[model samples]
Target: MQVVKQLNPLIFLAPLAMLSLPLGAPNSITQSLALLLLAPIAFIATKSAIKKPIFITILIGTLLVSLFQVALNPNKEYSVYQAIRSALPFYLLCAIVVSYKKILARIIAFEDRTPGSVQKLFDRAVRVFATLSFIQTTTFFLGFSLANALSQSENDRVMIFQTTSIVLVFFYSIIRRNFINIFLTSIVIIGTGSKAIFVATLLLTFFAAYSRPKFSMLLKIVGGTLILGGTLFYFNPLVIERLAEFAINSDGEKFKDATREYEIEQAKETLLENPATTVLGAGFAMQVSHGVPSLDPAWEENSKYDIENGYWGALVKLGFFFTMLFALSIAKGLPRDEFLMAILLVQSVMFMKTSYQLFAYMDGVCMLLWSICMVAINKINANRNSHQSQFQQSIQR
Candidate 1:
């Protein structure tokens, strides 16, 4: 309880969104919790972004267009609620979180004032989350179920938030060449069957280790690739359970996500459906449909959008101009740290798979944003400690 209390407001919404379990770490529950945290977040962000006019303008533009977008929607009642829930994650990042350079700077300053308080809280929270995630993964592998991992489909589980802290450890293990953590974290991540997360982690790990390019690093990469390739072609447990989806699913077909191409075509049609939708954007929960027979099994109804692709997702919702503007706005807030930058770089490629950056799943957005915050805390403290050590050594001399 005290550990949660010790969390700096900058990272508060993140943990709150991730740990929100009623919806089983899905977007709905996380967004609901994020909405609850918005008031305090907005208060903090107002103070934090006082000097950042771009952020203020972006917020204003979003609200104005969103109001217009909502009014234009035929299903106003549901759309109003849908729009609010979808955007809450974006609103709740009030470190305001997207302003990474400034927010991380504030966190560093807090560390200076309080010594090790925030870092300790962060580490402790991550340990708890990582353990829960590991247990869930283990349970899934052992032919059982826990919580809501298999609620949607046999092999499908969205544990992005739960796996996020562990991904940070996975990221750091590559940086430090810690084989034990690298192996353990790898299993938990891949077991979740998250293509975006696993691929992002693997790519970043490769880039970081490639900088050194030792024999061992190359050998690790080759060995790892071969193993993964083998599993994919051979006895992959992750998908083995998916066969059960057909037998148990009422639809009498295996539940599956729409292909990225299918989602893209549907989104394009919806975007160009009318001049108002084109110019102002479709307000909240706008459902796109096609004549295709198979449907997104996760949804109660088949309303698919190309939201898995962050850019395409935004384009459908906010039009070209606003979407591009939002993109630029995010660019302004990206971290300057090389390591953090590398993670974002990989995710950019995988945006076609999922959008953890903007209004994807609240849990994932919270998890990833929280993971970045944790990385910043650790990196800043380590650098400061190193400088302090050097200064003491100089004084002794």
Candidate 2:
């Protein structure tokens, strides 16, 4: 164990964290290979006391959910196998981030500093985070481009990535005051053709700008109004058409009609037909029978759309209880408003379409959430100690 620890410590783990990039590119062999490389790093980095409780709780919860799903699933062999494969890496990554002492210390140091130091540290942190965000987003888009170039398919990767990119852009906008990056990011987000993301990004930007008193009220109002108006006018019809067609039919709609209404109606029926399934859910791999094709269906399928909505998809697979727990985990894990808002926007975008690829994986977003939690926990600990020290001094006096 000592030899293992020495061979695979924080320095070795850094690259694994780096490799957890956002690109949803199709490379099964590469992903497996990367996992092999990260396994040792994961082992070494995940060795801290503070993170142990968090890791244990999440692991236990996940295991319980998986165990229940396996027992209930009619096709247990395949479902259990796939669930473990998909979930274990996320668990390891969470543990690795939590146990990494040096990273934790640095974050605690930054958070416990004076105001001027905090500002400087914040700037440096923002720059680093923004760079990481940029790398992930760029790699994802490039992967999509490469895949499409090879396969001759023009379909975008998914909606959530676009929304995540917008969130990152919003953060960068706050720090750099570089509207060009924001503008470019806005364009890339729009390129995905996700209506929810487009609207969420607009609102996110407006609120972000409004949060600060530096901008005049009038500028904030005007800027916000313009964003709202542009999105409503430009993106509305296309998104409405796409979504409407997606809801009712098993295939995506060819043209815009009242497809969304029909799809919602169908989803309601599906839910009503399976009341028992509602509480505990249909099981992990139940979607294969829900009419969504293994390959992309030409038409919209209601169940297919659910996969795109992270909140609902989890509910359908893991049960209502687990879904609620996971949601709470996300909330507890996010410390800052900006981070929470970013994730919320991504979730909203996810809810608006059929994008399994986007919301399914735990990647950079999970890492960020864990980091935020570490900082929050560290800060709380520091404040408690400070208060205790003051009390002791007063008693001595």
Candidate 3:
């Protein structure tokens, strides 16, 4: 019984650890199957945790939207299997986060009793994972073809794992005020060559510093940002070039105006052709099958569907009403802390470019953030309660 109790935390950590596995470690199908299998265990473990009404509402809303889509678009080339494949990871991740709430409290209580142990464990794990990722990234940059040796899919998987590790370490360092960890993790994140992650990290660091607003914290933030910028500028100039290219393309230039005009025209035609789909979306499988048309010929050639924006993708998959409800649910579920709000804002921006909500790896990072925030809140409340108890005892004496 004691051993079983001890292992309960692992139920929550298993999916996260699985997510951190290198691309060569497991194929995508196997990794996905592993997460699916873990979902049931998570559900079973978290059965005792209190369920939030907002979460239930979101889950119900998702189901209703899916059902309505299926019912209304019977003639559309929709696949129930494909929809489940796309949606299950999200639902399972939700369950894991909800269930881990209780387990996290317990872990925190244990950490309070054993000072530095939890931090040490996390630091060791992060250092090991981040080191491996750094090595891989450096090898790739040195023209070793290590990353290219793997298939494109595998390479993407590896990068996702590395990115996830960097995010985890980054947040952990922020909470613990571990500068060394922060410096090392930032290097790995920049090495990934993802402009979005770079921007997200910077945003998170700024918000974290702003939350406290101490002079020292401000100095560290400035110093860290400069170091990151200088390192990237010297070693990986392409990141800056790509970001500049994106900014130029996104500006209200003639090309952008033309592209926007063409997209709007195509969208109007689609809505007119399928009026009902305008309300509840054309469903994922259908949307994928009949690709969303794009004004940019290059974009269309690159991707089957040119719905690069996550909000637009949500509208395509769930329609306006359901998308609104989903957004509301997320808003209601998030913590009120400014730091957390900043993280969510960063995540929201990334979601615009890609469907981060549906990806298990990104979801895991979110869950980690949620857990950290909840634990910090709990600690604060506990301290307050302790102070109250001491004051009451003094008054009685």
Candidate 2 residue-wise lDDT, 97-167, digit = tens: 45544544444554454223433444344334444445544444556332211011244423332235345
All candidates' lDDT scores?
Answer: 0.57, 0.46, 0.55
Off by over 4 Å in 3: 23-41, 44-57, 96-106, 109-120, 143-158, 162-165, 250-276, 292-306, 359-397
**Alpha carbon lDDT at 229, candidate 3:** 92
257 in model 2: Cα distance from truth in Å? 10
Give candidate 2's error at residue 128 in angstroms: 9.2
Supply candidate 2's per-residue lDDT for 334.
39
Q: Using Cα atoms with residue i matched to residue i, what is each candidate's TM-score against the true structure? A: 0.74, 0.58, 0.74
Q: What number of clashing residue pairs does each candidate have, in the order they appear?
A: 1, 9, 0
lDDT of 1 at 132: 55
Compare the candidates by TM-score and give the number of the best one.
3
The prediction achieving the highest lDDT against the true structure is 1
Model 1 lDDT, residue 9, Cα: 45
* Residue 78, model 1: Cα distance from true site in angstroms: 6.3
Cα deviation at 6, candidate 3, in Å, is 4.2
